[model samples]
Target: MEQLKLAARNARKKTIVPVKQVRIGEGFVVIAGPCSVESEEQMLITARMVKEAGADMLRGGAFKPRTSPYAFQGLGLEGLKILEKAGRETGLPVVTEVVDPRDVTWVCEFADVLQIGTRNMQNFALLKEVGKANKPVLLKRGMYSSLKEWLYSIEYILNAGNPHVILCERGIRTFETYTRNTLDISAVPAMKELTHLPIIVDPSHATGRVSMIESMSLAAVSAGADGLLVEVHFKPEIALSDKDQQLNPRQFKQMMWKLRKLVQFHQQLAKQKSPRGET
Candidate 1:
């Protein structure tokens, strides 16, 4: 019996260690911004609007990976500089995706979090490079990868001496014509059970339709997502990339209002269910 108790205590310690000490959303963190940093003016305007809408962090792509070589490849360092300026002005942490291992240092210098995009989830060298940096990282699940593969990709970061990691569910590729990608909602609950890391859902990328973002985002919260990462643009139709997934200012504000109500309700319910005689 004593031996069994000792084993159980050790297991508990391991679980407890991983659960705490990670920088994450306190309630429901909202990360929002444009799909790409078109110019200084565009990034600044969107940053201010998202901050006004109660977003916790801002997201923009400094280096875009396009399927076609002729497509726009983002503004690179200039965009990061613009993002840094916006972060300074708005007091919100900035998150930007890095596509190359060589740019890790420069990217980490400005952005609060380095996003490992879906296409680069399996980029072991790049993952190792970011892992060595002092900044936090957001790892997005690959469109065709399994949940196990996704979590193990996180292991690459944690093992490289950084514990500040976040998991993003950005949907997976499927044959459905109705949506851009099929959302794996069950992954939220499953991840909660398997890991202590915070999980944020990207309904924007999952559905690829602004009209569907609100519904999918609400559903993610219902399934216990820790936060949301959405694309917010002042103008969507003329945006450089992924215009279909971007939300205008008015729509984002509405979603934030509804999310606030849901968060409050959940907090109250949690309070009411406290264990007997517990604080």
Candidate 2:
């Protein structure tokens, strides 16, 4: 934990990670998009939808690390191109997963934020590579790693000289099989206490059910999460991956409506608690 001093929250101020024009940690930020970039049309439509829904950033997987090799692996570089173009059109910065250390440079060229997925949380080489990249990194906590281990993995990235790291708690594996993964809401505040880096929640992957995402998203914000990473597709029924967990554009817009109110309320409470004249 001492290694994370640079990322440790000080009573004086909070760490605000800047990705392009979006300033995470300043308020409740939302990053929403499809789980994978299936096509040019899919990417653009979803990107525009999320942008309209009030997402601060767009997320899609270009190099997916699927449990089943037969599953829809991402569109590789083609997907990155589509995501970049969509981001340009929608005026939202793009965040995409980079599964290979070798592709970090290539991925950095197109991605405004490089994501180190839960599977690669402990991949030291990949962490180092992303840490060296010029883009901000979204580091997901490993599904099976302990809180300490997760912080240590983050240390790997910070140790490599990247100060722009965002911690994403996408949930962790537990005995309960009812949900795909257990949403560790406590991690939101726990991480805030442990590190100053902006911590976001991924409700889509956490609950693995669209029905729970809205509730969990609200809960996360109330619990002090800095932002949210959601899966929003234009057509979830036909989404190439994680269809059950992806919210359609209408659902996403509704959720955002509720979320915006919650965020405003949360900010108000925060302001009330802070010293007078402090932002």
Candidate 3:
């Protein structure tokens, strides 16, 4: 069971978008962009394509956390500048990760929604920084963190000041070697019961395969996720980060079509299930 104290704490606070901008009750929100900001052209190309696919928001990592020091880290402030430019051009809200607590101010200046990536879920200091930002925040579960700890992390943000925090189940580390991480579909309904915060799923990172995005996304919405955070690239094979999980423009468009239909059906079902004039 989740700690009700934190849940209650989150309930009384206000959100950045009034629960209507990012997404509505069980309304599917599609957030897509490159896994990491590579260059000006790369970011704009992906953002334009995703916007054309009807994505509700655009996501990209400006300060990526790489396991290997030699791997390409994000473009830092330059990457953020690219994302901002894309958002301006496409009219899609920008979402990106903030790896360090000190960069909170810089990120808030560009990103519409501040993302606390899975690697930074336990960064209490960073969480506090986002908690105080005026923008809405997207918080991902750590690869090794528990559900309880996940909620507590949310508390860390809520207690700090900000309340427009969205939970994202990006998958967790496990013994299985077949996939990058174990996508915890159960976290969807479990989180719903534990808190009113809107929840989203990241199928790209969860399965670490482009082919699995459609099915996992469908399952996520079916499981009651409020939105999806997908990684889209003009050419996934050459993406700077998480190339294996990135979706090409064509694949992303197809998934978006299916998601639109599913969201409509789910909304109809919800209306029918509710008591007359209750919802």
- Best TM-score among the predictions, by candidate number: 2
Residue-level lDDT tens digits of model 2 in 81-141 = 9999998999899999999989999998998999999999999999999889899899999
Task: Please write out the lDDT profile of model 1 over residues 1-279, one tens digit for every residue.
Answer: 222222122333222212112246457788999999999898999999999999888999989988898899999999999999998898888899999999999998899889999999999999899989888888999999998778778878887887777889999998896999999999888877667677889999999999999999898888888889999998888899999999999999999999988888888888786789886
Residue 165 miss distance in model 2 (angstroms): 0.3
Q: Model 1's lDDT to the true fold?
A: 0.86
CA displacement after TM-score superposition, residue 72 of candidate 1 (Å): 1.0
* Candidate 3 deviant stretches above 4 angstroms: 1-4, 8-21, 24-26, 273-279
Q: What is the lDDT of candidate 3?
A: 0.86
Task: Quantify all predictions' global Cα lDDT against the true fold.
Answer: 0.86, 0.91, 0.86
Candidate 3 positional error at 142, Å: 0.7
Error of 2 at 147 (Å): 1.1
Steric clash pairs (candidate 2): 7-196
Off-target runs (Cα >4 Å) in candidate 2 are: 3-13, 273-279
Location of the lowest summed lDDT over 10 successive residues in candidate 2: 3-12
RMSD per model, one decimal = 5.1, 2.9, 3.2
